[model samples]
Target: MSKLVNKSQCVVICCFPANYTVGLTTVVEALALGIPLICTKNVQMPMDIDHEHCGITVEPGDMGGWEKAVNYIAENPDVASDMGRRGRELAEKVYNLDNCAKDVSAVLKTLIKK
Candidate 1:
């Protein structure tokens, strides 16, 4: 999956609300691979893809919106590249394992002190 995503221009993760578990495995994978994303707004996401400037969201079941999104990425190379870069930066900030361990230890230490 990582290899495939690394080679992808962008990733589209369109799904219905409650169609499956709203895990961010695919999303984080795309971010880690530095690929821009087009996902459904139905997703129960932890972060704002739009606010993060990592991707755009489409209304669920909107075929025209999907078409527009793909065209936007294909036609706007600079913007797409920026989005991918931002995605990678966000993944590094939020998902780096070493940073995660440090954050967890801080919380644990605080609890221990309490």
Candidate 2:
């Protein structure tokens, strides 16, 4: 998943569970890899994906949103490219795998210490 985002030409991640919290991991990954993203509001995507600047947000299961998102990226190459760049930068700093590993390690260490 990370590698795809890192090397893919573009990405559109649609999530289920309307109330789910969207993880910005994929979006961030795509961004870091210079790939554009299209996400939905079903979950709270990390801050970067939340903003339309980094990607498009569609209402879950809404065909219109899907079309619009796709169209937006296809029609506006500059915006999409810029967004991919931003997403990549955000991912490198905030969603890096090392950062996630460190956070998980801290939680486990605390649990063991307890």
Candidate 3:
């Protein structure tokens, strides 16, 4: 697991179980460690993944689907690395206290403006 996390140019997450939010934490950890994500649409992962911008999603259980996703990410090292950097940026933007508060405040102010 650690090697995959360490040496992988990209990280592919295959999650298909119902209510499987378990992978989210690990995905976030990978992002924190600068790993790009190639995930499946299964278990709400497509929504979690940032589409082709930060991650690629493929239909679950398609033969070679996982490989395709990983290869796609691997083929474009620049895009993959940018996505990894963006993932960390997103985490900082959404998870940090100051950034979270600012985002919340902006949303609340927008609601009040209506």
Write candidate 1's Cα lDDT for 5-112 as tens digits: 687889998887775546377888888888899988754587788999999888889999999999999999899999999999999989677876898899999999
| Residue pairs with backbone overlap in model 1 | none
- Find the 10 residues in a row with the least total lDDT in model 1: 16-25
> Which lDDT value does model 2 have at 2?
64
- Ranked candidates, highest lDDT first: 1, 2, 3
Using TM-score as the yardstick, the better of models 1 and 2 is: 1
Question: How far does residue 26 in candidate 2 sit from its true spot (Å)?
Answer: 3.1
Candidate order, TM-score descending:
1, 2, 3
Model 3, span 32-113: residue lDDT tens: 6777877766564423575536677667686588777777787888988898888777666554558657878999999999
- Model 2 lDDT, residue 10, Cα: 60
- Scored against the true structure, residue 105 in model 1 reaches a CA lDDT of 99
Q: Which regions of candidate 1 deviate over 4 angstroms?
A: 19-23, 99-114
Instruction: Note the Cα lDDT for every prediction shown.
Output: 0.86, 0.72, 0.71
lDDT per residue for candidate 2 within 3-110, as digits (tens), equals: 655655468887775555655556655666777778777544446365646777777789988997898788888888888888767778877889889999999999
Error of 1 at 6 (Å): 1.1
Comparison by TM-score, 2 against 3, better one: 2
lDDT value for candidate 1?
0.86
